[model samples]
Target: MEELIYFHDHALVILTLITIIVFYGLISIITNTFTNRFLLESHHIETIWTVIPAIILIFLALPSLRLLYIMDELNDPHLTIKAIGHQWYWSYEYTDYQDLEFDSYMVPTQDLNPGQPRLLEVDNRLVAPTHSPVRVLTTSADVLHSWAIPALGLKMDAVPGRLNQLSFLTPRSGVFYGQCSEICGANHSFMPIVLESVPLNVFEDWASSLME
Candidate 1:
């Protein structure tokens, strides 16, 4: 996701610079004079230049629209999880598994394990099935917060009195981490999101046991 964002930004920067330089070069060549004398163009000439930019925008809008549509597409999901943001912690509910729910609190520094990442580790990591589409519903109990997972390209705001939905399909079985993006309160930085994607059978077993 980081690489994708970087490449997208790089493309925009390069294209913007090239477009500006090309437009300036064309104006300079057509005017044939560096002085301000050539700047006083006729109404028709000014209209032509304006229309040229409009034409360029039409071409640029196609790709921009496609990217927007692709980013908003949500596939058929196999499981659903609702994440509710509290004052300083997160509560997750498996909506399809008898509504089994748990609170995921930030692990203290002294409790950190060798493999655990400081500040991003939680006591109860969210569990999902690998290679399956998981739809996430988000809401806030108090102030606003944001749920984000970089590896799966998932981010949504947990607004009070409203529900927002986002979905992702994990291609591999592993743990992915993220943090609350919005600053809700003093412990906002401590609200980390941890996802554990396991095999389908394993996930089913865990979910069944959780309901019991």
Candidate 2:
């Protein structure tokens, strides 16, 4: 199901372009016909034409709603992490690991390695285990910020006083990047997010080290 959603993301881009082209062609045809004919005005033709975008919407809404519900439905999570957004940095707490916490700040572009992506790498990344259900609790310390990761299909607003919950299970190990989607301050663009998913054994080892 995850793979299907990932594929749909790309498919949606193509579908969107096709939809735009078809709509454009239809409008052009209508305009050309009305312009060439002096007796019929475009407004007269418009009265007979009713766009039932609802039909297209119905098809698009089903899969999207299904995915939304699935993402929100909480199962027995193997781990839980709390993320708090501050002025220009992020703090993470592992609730299941004795509430161990740490701060994750963005690495400056000048200090990045040759293969590292500018403005996307961070000093400390939120780490988790692959193929494990992890629940995330998000909140803000001061202003509103959004935690978004496109690959995981996760995005939730971090409100100052409210806690928002989200969950995901990464099928593979890799580093996923995101940023402060909402404009919160002067350095909003500099507040990047990086998540590293490792093997279960590696995660357990890392968690143990954090405890020490």
Candidate 3:
């Protein structure tokens, strides 16, 4: 999400510039048409419209292609977590560690802690280290599901018997939340994804404790 947010901000800047240019162009065209009429040849007008749009498209396409490339650049991950979507819950297994796994169930609103988000809090949160590449392999236990974290700009469908991989890094230590994006069945709303990003040493300690 750290890099994704930067990309989004860049896109917004481009869009804002485009909007301003179009607005000014429209105002100028309207003014010229009502005041001084200089009729250009049809071919000349066609060429102007076509070439300008082509240039703009190229400009837009360049950034879009760069962003896509950035999105696809999967690095050698430091940690890998396997996520299995069930009927009404998400179970996560830390593949890098031995026998470290947990089922994450959404914390009911009535049971939420002081700072916990209602419906977004989970009993078990997937923990990872900050500023490191993390890979998530997703699959389904029963039906179709989608593991999505909006902040990270990550969404991968969990298909039964098939695995979908997602990779990203947290810029800093914090808590990020998400939910099952796919409409699996009746209790779909109860499936929430909670991620706790901690410092590298803190993560190792937690993982070590789990092994004990």
Can you write out model 2's per-residue Cα lDDT over 93-192, one digit (the tens) per residue? Answer: 9988785899999888789989999988999899999999999999999999999888787889999999999998999999999998999999999888
TM accuracy, model 2: 0.77
Best by lDDT: 3
For model 3, the stretches where C-alpha displacement exceeds 4 angstroms are 28-39
Report the lDDT tens digits of candidate 1 across residue range 139-211: 9999999999877677899999999988777888999999999999998899999999999999989888888
Off by over 4 Å in 2: 1-58
Compute each candidate's TM-score over C-alphas: 0.79, 0.77, 0.89
Q: Which 10 residues in a row give candidate 3 its minimum summed lDDT? A: 33-42
Clashing pairs in 2: none
Report lDDT (Cα) of residue 77, candidate 2: 95
How well does candidate 3 match the true structure in TM-score terms?
0.89
lDDT of each: 0.86, 0.87, 0.87
Top-scoring candidate (TM-score): 3
Ranking by TM-score: 3, 1, 2
